[model samples]
Target: MRVFTVLGPSQAGKSTLVRAMAGLDKEAGQKLEAAGVVTLQPFSFMGEDWGAIEVAGGAENLAQAGPALAASDAAVVCVPADAEAAVLSAPYLRKVEEAGLPVFLFINRMDQTRDRVADVLAGLQTYCAHHLVLRQVPMREGGQVVGAVDLISERAWSYQDGKPSALVELPDGVRPREVEARGELLEALADFDDQLMEELIEDQEILVKEIYDVATRTLQHSQLIPVFLGAAEHCNGVMRLMKSLRHEAPPVEQALARLSPGGRVVAVGCMGELVKHLGKSVLLRAMNADCSSGTEMAGQAIGGLTMVAKGGNGSLAMGDLGRVVKSDHLRLGQVYLKDGARALPDWAQPRPATYRRLVTPVHQRDEARLSTALERMGEIDPAMEVTQDEATGHALLNLQGPQHLRRVIQTLKAEFGVEVTEDMVPPALRETITKPVEIHHRHRKQSGGAGQFADVVIAIKPLPRGSGVTFDDCVKGGAVPRNYIPSVEAGAREALMQGTNGHPVVDVAITLKDGKHHSVDSSDYAFRMAGKAAVREALGEAGLVLLQPIVKVAIHVPSVFSGNLVPMVSGMKGQILGFEAEQDAAGWDLFETLLPMAAQDELCSALASATRGTAWFQSGFDHYEEARRGDFGAK
Candidate 1:
């Protein structure tokens, strides 16, 4: 069984293409028809024939499609003609590459205005250095895209109404470029083998079988990206598409890792223990490590462990999740641990997932459905947890990316009855003290009821980073009652959180030196007042400075991107990690530097835009720095 994913921008005819290719409604049982040219159903080649599974355009669709595709033999990417729309394939392509799967590009909507086939050809040649072989070119007649010729088969097909007809001879009345296009395609396909090279060089006829074999080999190794020209709308060139997928696309690229059992449930995919993301499957094993179906997420699975062996090709297609096509001869599940697993620790919970903000309708009520939908998302990504802010009641999902965020909103409207929209919110930021400072809070309100009164004088100090809040009461004789100590700490801590710099306070310590407490009036409430006063007073008297979080990041940049990254990083007040000279086949350089987490504002967009989707990196918090101190801001 092999998995073929159809990737393209929304409404780029991807859904139409898949429906046409699968022959879902055909009474003739899945025949490949071209525009008045060919009615052909070649061989149906794939393992575990659960049939073609079509995934729609949405996050949930991706979640369902990901594992299915990951478990498939191949992926057929539908590239859109619009420049802006062409980007839809990027995320799916990255996911396929991570899964060790082979991918083929099918330039979609060829009937519409294409970006001069020469330009599309050139772009693919430059960026997709892995596998970019052109297998077919459009056949034009009367200045319209009437049909196309298969480069390997050397046959022309035309559309009869919407259905394809029998293979026909090449039309004579055609523009000069159409003939030239066919010759160019043949030359591209022939470059994969020496025999074809010799034939083309000698001006001799090359055997058709030889071309197919070479193209298949090149494509399997990802040396060929078979470009199919077609309008999925009219299903004109779709027959040839189905044929190309059957012959040239690789059978499967197995998940480099699998699930194994022993002392603990471990991830066995890709490199390290991390199972490369099979689309958006929930990690099988989470920190809250339970494997029961009720507890396990729908798309959720475990990753982030080591694999002892390289994977072989095989596939599985989930019914609701979709189907997998088999290609590689390797049987992975057999080698993995299907039993003898363990569970997570007693105190286990899912990881903290990030999300963008969403606002559902107010007058319209469907919160039950909204909650169910959000909970279902948890299966695809455990981190994609949901939370409704208490004050705002806003539906929020911690998402990984902008694409993921958009998909969630669409799912809400389409799947659930809730109408939801997203607004990318700037992450909540905090400021801390650059240096130790004395801050105090005082309160003495003597009114009618019991005459409440309290006075607290204490010392405020900052500790080393990450120590967290700690409080001590050093009242020698009973200046402040010992029983009210916890209350005082609470009051002081509260003031710290609402810092003068308008950021959270960190790495600070405070000591309650002395305070006055009345016999009847000096209750916990009185001490709380005293502690509050002391904190506010210390803050006013002791010098204060602003502090910010500094995140240590190790980025791998392609050597070519280093020069560009230098200026970009520095522009955001970032330090240039000069030790980025090394690079490999992945074309990566290792850079270690510290950046403000706050600087992460719009940083993801800038990085992706700069790298043109070819580069990505990870970041984590290192420590907090005194931002407003004397020269302390410099790294």
Candidate 2:
């Protein structure tokens, strides 16, 4: 079976086309939401089984498609013919290209569009890395597309609304355009095949099988995209699209060859609610052989096996998607072989979450339930991360975007019965000494049986930012006992946890210069108290300074907004390093700067609004700097 995923921008008619391909009603299923993955019934293509999965076009949902693209044997990118051909599916196209999967473009809703096919194809070429060769050209009637001509077979078809196209002779009006498109398709395929190039150069006739072979190889290597046209609402041109998939898409063995060899079974998706008796449902993609119930997959018994398509059941052959149960060692996007597990490359890893929201139970009494609910949610949506902020002790849900976060929140409330509200994350700060200070302190207790007594002298100095807390013992003449000295250092370190500024102390060094300990009266406890007292005295004398955490941030936006960055970062007390053209993304600039953590919330929200949701930024902890008097509501 061949697994093909449909990816496109929102409302591109992706789901409808997928349903038509599977012989289902176009309007039968619910509209797709963020992270929605729908599997259609298995259908035969050239007498071989094939399954199709549709991925919704929401920006946040595209992150989830990366894993599916990596898992599938091929992909179909959908674009609406009626809308401006802005290549809104660029992100998905890039991901599919990176995965080295065979991909084809479906120009859907053609019956509603009046745009010239040449103009639409030109716009798509800007976003696609490789050439998009037109495999089929639209046939127009009464100034609208009524059918399409196949470039490969030199065949034309006239549409019968709500039914398969009826084959017809090449139209006299479209003959010249068909010949030109066929030549272009052959030229693109020839670039990848030396023999084909020689034949084309020699003006020799080429067999359809030879052209198809070259096209299949070119597509499998991601060197070209074959374009198909259709209005899935009327099921027009759907059969030809499936035929192209059947002939051009590579087999499962060849597709899985790019992945590590050890994995006989690989699972692309992680969420399924089947096989309750086996504890959890596990979806597995076969790479080498067929599987059945009670089959031991990767040393775990498959208590049950179910097919992905509707009414499809029984043993799963190579390249089929099915649900397995009773597997204890299974994980998301993992490859399991009889010997060991195979890891996916870095690109296959889920994208880092760009949006963060602090969450807490509305009633504060369902914290535990919230934790469990988040864990289950994470299990279901691997792209969405749920973690606790160490500094603020707040529950933070890091997701791809606001839409993805909203879906997770909705699931938490509706499925888990846990109501939560977004909360403000507190600013995290550090404390350090501004100047060095020397202090002497005595810890004497005369109200006890042994009457404790100890005297300690120490010097405190500030280190460079990020140096953290350091301790050195420079005692002389046994002034401080070796065994008692450890306790003294421990007490001093403990005191630094909450400095005079009520924050963790950092970048300070303490030296034990001299101290006196009575062998009979003074013990570890007394010396510890003396050390703590000495540190406190030094802190007061030296005066503590509040330091704010600075982050190294890189903001990527369309070049049009490059001028807005300086003022934007400066407004948040940020220091700009520089900016340059972003190499990975064309027509975009990358601005590098240092920003305080307190300003991150405003920056994230503002950037999206300013760039019309085209710009984004990522940050990492850089160092700590002295906070300005008025920064971050500081006193």
Highest TM-score: give the candidate number: 2
**Residue 614 of model 1: what lDDT?**
40
lDDT of 1: 0.52
Model 1 RMSD vs true structure: 11.1
TM-score per prediction, in order, is 0.59, 0.88
Error of 2 at 423 (Å): 2.8
- Candidate 1 lDDT trough over 10 residues, lowest sum: 266-275
Error of 1 at 602 (Å): 6.3
Candidate 1 lDDT for residue 427: 34
Which regions of candidate 2 deviate over 4 angstroms? Answer: 24-41, 44-47, 82-87, 140-143, 166-176, 266-279, 309-313, 326-328, 358-373, 392-396, 554-591, 602-618
lDDT of 2: 0.76
Cα lDDT tens digits, model 1, 287-343, are 112222222222233222211011122211221111111111111121112332222
lDDT of 2 by residue, 1-635 (tens): 67888888778898788778877333232222223453444565555666676777755676666556666788899888843544365556656766777888999998999898888888777556678899999899899898899898888998878899999988899999999999989988888899999999999999988888888888878888889999998999888888888777888877567675544444444234222233445566777777777665556656667775433458777787777665555555556665456555566656667577899888778988899777755654667777798866768888777777777777777667788888656667998998999988889988757989889998999999889888989998899988888878987887788887688888999999898988789998998888888898888888788999888989866666778777888988899999997665544688899998888878877776676554667788899999998876666
- The candidate 2 region of ten consecutive residues with least summed lDDT is 25-34
Reference-based TM-score, model 2: 0.88
